[model samples]
Target: MIIEPRSVAIIGASNDQDSVGYALVKNTMSARCDVFLVNPNHEEIEGKKCYPSVKDIPYEVEAAIIAVPAKVVPDVLKECGEKKVKYVYIISAGFAEAGNVDLQDKLVSIANRYGVKIVGPNCLGLMRPGYVNATFAPYEPKSGGIGFISQSGALVDAMVDMAKESYGFSAIVSVGNSAMLDITDFIEVLDQDEKTKVIAIYMESIKDGREFINVVKKAKKPVVVLKSGKSERGAKTALTHTGKLATDYSVYRGAFRQAGAIEVNTFTELFSVSVLMELVGEVDDMVVVTNAGGGAVLASDYAEKYGVDLIDLRKETIRRLDKVLPEHYSRQNPLDIIGDATSERYWKALDILMKEKYVKSAFVIVTPQLMTDVDNIAMVVAKIKQKYKKPIVCSFIGGSRVKNAIHYL
Candidate 1:
């Protein structure tokens, strides 16, 4: 109901331009649903009628967003329950994370009594592009394939800004504190969503380990997790951040491997792996097509370290490449097509490599050599990718010179 609400009520909508309440109202005003603003002190805001509470709205609200103070949350939640609102997203802070466990417990008790599901007590709500912007985030991400669920709202904000011109998202959720609904619940929901091809998570801790494993094991789509709090100092910080203890990293890693979820170390890897999985479902045999031998060596080292199989080129595959590539080019996996290669060389080499039935994907690496046409090579790679419908991760390795080519790809 939260993701595709037919009608929504903003419980603490404000007219003050600087308040979170005001931001919620402004961001949600464009949602494709009936929006009702509620505030006891205001009769009208921006020429629209403001109700005193959810009960006064005179319409059934599928979901309600609570942005009031922590002490005031219980009463507002009870009002939502009375109004039969099933989903409530609390954007207010000062709960368990603030050492106010009793206050958080009170909200949970009221919600359970009313049979309501809650998203957060200290969080940046959620966003479903073109449907609803139930968040105070400054940017609404472009609609795409990844469903991002994170414990850190600020990280989601940062990712939104960084991914503005790059890949987009199917949904973005911030499950802060996880008082009632945890990361597993959101993961299950996104796994069933047809629009979501990949599920990316930024997790600090899990409420239920056994249930999490079960859910991930049963998930139909790919799950990519970027866990934090691995160090002793980081664990204490994470505990204070979400009111949950960060467990041993080894235990989590083993569980993730058992459940077939991809565990990434950094933020960039989290989305990068997710995007790759979204583009090409599951691939094992990969080949590297590069213009720089040094780049190919680095790729080979990483592939071996990560246990990724860089398939050995067959005699026939090498024979086919020999006709197109220069005689000086390395005639093996990570087919280095020499540093002084042009777009035509890239086109020919990639065309031959992608046609090989044994190759599942190609990693095209290009260093900005004196003769390298980065932009044209990027176009050739895109064309070959489209023609074969195969996954190709291009690494145009350079700054300034490769920026436009990277953007074009």
Candidate 2:
């Protein structure tokens, strides 16, 4: 499986600080696996002895990362096959996407002959949290419930850095070119991983649509997809990017919904929805708690636009809120606590809202007002969030003044 490897060999390991090969070798220094550097030209890289080839290494290698020039990838794969490596990650480019489709096929054929699973031919490598930092990305993500599979290696880098607080990953695979093991294969692998409670993907196109739908439909956890290539021009761009023909956007959209995957339009929505899904399973009935009336109104309108159900508070619940809130406050779904709200006020409101049977989760939107204690409110929200086993997302919608509040959450 891509999530765990006993040992790894950097087939094109190098010492040049500016090259991709250098980054690959440098990033693996912290990998928990046994890492071997391989290069016929170098005696050693980063103080690790460089093996002449995979076959030359004395120990068995589970994963071999091909980082040499595209022309040398076939020979490298041959060495990996002879060495009996189970998994391979090809970081070299100039394959199918670069008008070298035959060369890409040859690489795939070698892997199939050896019964090896390939992650990529022209993409960033995969990273298993606490196991290996195989990708060229500089940071290693903290282990979490989301398993992210991406077509764009650059997007993977951005997402890994973007993750914080509750949003992190169990594993990340950049299925570039997907010469042998495509998105479907990786999805099937993650679907069975117990650590992964949620699956997120960034895709330009699907390699096998039918298999993809079948696998996703049977997934036990939530699947979140951020698909590109909607417009004619964008589809053409995707072709140039991944060397795969982009299907009609409508077909992909419908298929994703049919397979029970939540298709998102932007990167932000993809991660936001994924975080909420992992944190609060199958929760749709949400309460919007805000200090500003306009913020509440806007949230309510967007909730309807996005097909999110706003739980109508029970009469008894409203009465309880009425006792806790000011006289002018509206005791509705968007429980506006007025502009001069304090942390305790927010605490009492959230405390009551969370108790309602219909309220599964909440969105705490705080528009910074002159009298609003932003930090205190954030503290209260954080405290209340801990007591409940539900999702609570905070939107401290402001500039420099709200930085501390965001940090607290």
Candidate 3:
């Protein structure tokens, strides 16, 4: 079953509080996961007595979490197989990445024999807020709505922070090394999850490439991806370690298009797209409002590249804009208010466009100069947003002020 498993086991359990295993245990337990510890060396960890092996554990293991050394992983899985553990998560590093191809092959072989499902051979592990205990860092995420799958362990933690601080998520997991389990597996699983409204993924490659395309194509919810290894070196690292073929980025791009998934460039894009996925009713139409012509021009360029139409203002809309904006600034798709625009102009333009049938989304570009008061503009925009239900995105380009605002908003 690709859904969340109720029971779980932790292999390579440790006594060191500072260790990744310790953190994994702490976070998952915080989420109220039905956790069972298996560490022969320790009598108990964090008040829970440890089992010596998966075989020694009393309950049936639904999922197995491994956090021990890389070399000992096969033996652990062997024990898991003996105990009939269905799912195995390996957080130890040292295989193809350590230039040990044979080791990676052996692990894969062992897993396939017993029909073992693996998450990572060298990684921080999975964390699904909706599922049981996570194997990420010490901090577990509070269950919410969105589901996330990341490739890097560190990035997974970073995204966890963003998920909690920004738009909340349902779960988080890392598909490190992707020996047996992979991005597709999680995507296919989240595909059916009721809690998963939005999916933000950090992936380098997909194992079953064709099936990956099919899953996203069939997915009703939006999938936001920040794919790394766009370059040759990056593609190499993504492929060699995960046992996945890092094909041309163009192929993946085309696949995403065919699958109807939105590809993002940065974490900001990932979150913004997902947030917009909920806030906006339709994505094809957008209105670009800016006081700076250059800023409007750049926004138009971005819109053109994405195939998103930026609509021109209606005649009445132009008349309204002309009452407030400078005479030189034309009433066009960008609706540039020019440099001399007052606070009233900003709010007025927003109100007029918010009512427009063609404008499903709004992009506000602000480049404040000597005459422009950033706070004054933000206040006007925020007020206008409060008035309108349509989703509005603010781009404070060309300054740290906007970057600061971007993060805050």
Go through the candidates in order and give each one's C-alpha lDDT.
0.89, 0.86, 0.75
lDDT order of candidates, top first: 1, 2, 3
Q: Tell me, by TM-score, which candidate is best.
A: 1
What are the per-residue Cα lDDT tens digits for candidate 2 across 1-409?
5678889999888888888889989888988889999999999987889999899999989898888899989989988998999999998888888889999999988988988888788888868887788778867788888889998888888877887454778999998888888888888889899888888899889977888899988888888899899989989888777788788999998788678788788999988888777877655789989988999989988776455678888899999998989998887888888999988899999999887767889999998888888999999888888887677878899998899889877
Error of 2 at 211 (Å): 3.2
Tell me which residue pairs clash in candidate 1: none
TM per prediction? 0.89, 0.85, 0.82
Clashes of each: 0, 0, 3
Off by more than 4 A, model 1:
272-282, 304-309, 322-331, 340-345, 371-376, 400-404
lDDT of 3 by residue, 184-228 (tens): 878878868888777889888887779998888777777888888
| Candidate 2 C-alpha error for residue 13, in Å | 2.2
**Lowest summed lDDT window (length 10), candidate 3:** 276-285
| Model 1 per-residue lDDT tens digits across residues 252-323 | 887787787888889889888888878876556899988888999999997764446799999998999888
